[model samples]
Target: MIGVLVTFTQNEKFDRSTLAGIASELRGPFEGMAGLRFKSFMLDEDGVQARNFYVWDDEEKGRSFFTKELVDKVTGVYGVPPTIEYLDIVGFVDNSGT
Candidate 1:
């Protein structure tokens, strides 16, 4: 699978409520996309950083979504640019005993 890690610093005066709203809007669309397996988000207000872990079925699918259109849309919502790293998962350990 392919994974994407995104890290970003929020604008100092950014509104938390707006950030929450944007995140909420994104969940549905991301979950509905083909090849998107899962996503996890982490926010550190004290550190002024946010991270997103995204798992996709393959590299192509992940790359397609990182186009200018998507970046522009995301930047518009966050009011700050993000740095993203795309990676290929060679191994994993799932301990969920379901």
Candidate 2:
């Protein structure tokens, strides 16, 4: 698996409620997204940043998803550019099922 960390930092603070709403609206589309194992939307209101974490089945799909277009699109949404980091998934734990 490949782990991806996408961080969006804004000069202005973001509303927690608004971020939650966005996450709620976006959940359905990502629930069964291909090549995506898991995804999380995280917010740091005090820090004025939102971090999105993703786990992909492979590096190719993960890297391919973060194209220039994606960055531009998200910059428009978040009002700032993002920093993307990809890392080898050394270990993972899922306790959803016994």
Candidate 3:
């Protein structure tokens, strides 16, 4: 499995609520996306940051999804660039349905 962390910092020109709205609007597109296990949209209103965490079943898919084009596109949307980090997920625990 692979985990990706994408963070967008708030800037003078951008509001976090706009990003949150975008996330809400795009949630359905990601719901049944192939190779995507889960995605979480997070915001730190006090800290002035937006973070998104994605868990993917396929590492290649996870890595390939974050392309330069994607970064640029999101930068345009947020009015600031994002910092992306990729992790090799060794294990996890889930009890949501249990």
| lDDT per residue as tens, model 2, 1-98 | 99999998877888788778878887998888899999999997486989899999988999999999989987887778999999899999988687
Pairs of colliding residues, candidate 3: none
TM-score of each: 0.80, 0.89, 0.86
Candidate 3 ranges beyond 4 A from true positions? 11-16
lDDT at residue 86 of model 1 (Cα atoms): 95
Among all candidates shown, the one with the greatest lDDT? 2
Q: Rank the candidates by lDDT, best first.
A: 2, 3, 1
Cα lDDT listed for each candidate: 0.77, 0.88, 0.86
Model 1's alpha-carbon lDDT is 0.77
- Relative to the unseen true structure, what is the C-alpha lDDT of residue 8 in candidate 3, on a scale of 0 to 100? 85
Higher TM-score: candidate 1 or 2?
A: 2
Model 3: how far residue 77 lies from native, Å: 1.6
Model 3 misses residue 62 by how many Å?
0.3
Q: Which ten residues in a row have the lowest lDDT in candidate 1?
A: 10-19
- Kindly list the per-residue Cα lDDT of model 1 for residues 16-67, writing each as its tens digit: 5665776788788777789987787667766477677898887898878788
The model with the greater lDDT, 1 or 2, is 2
User: How much lDDT does candidate 3 score?
Assistant: 0.86
| Tens digits of per-residue lDDT for model 3, 1-98 | 99999988865434656866988887998989999999998877565778889999999999999999999998887767999999999998878779
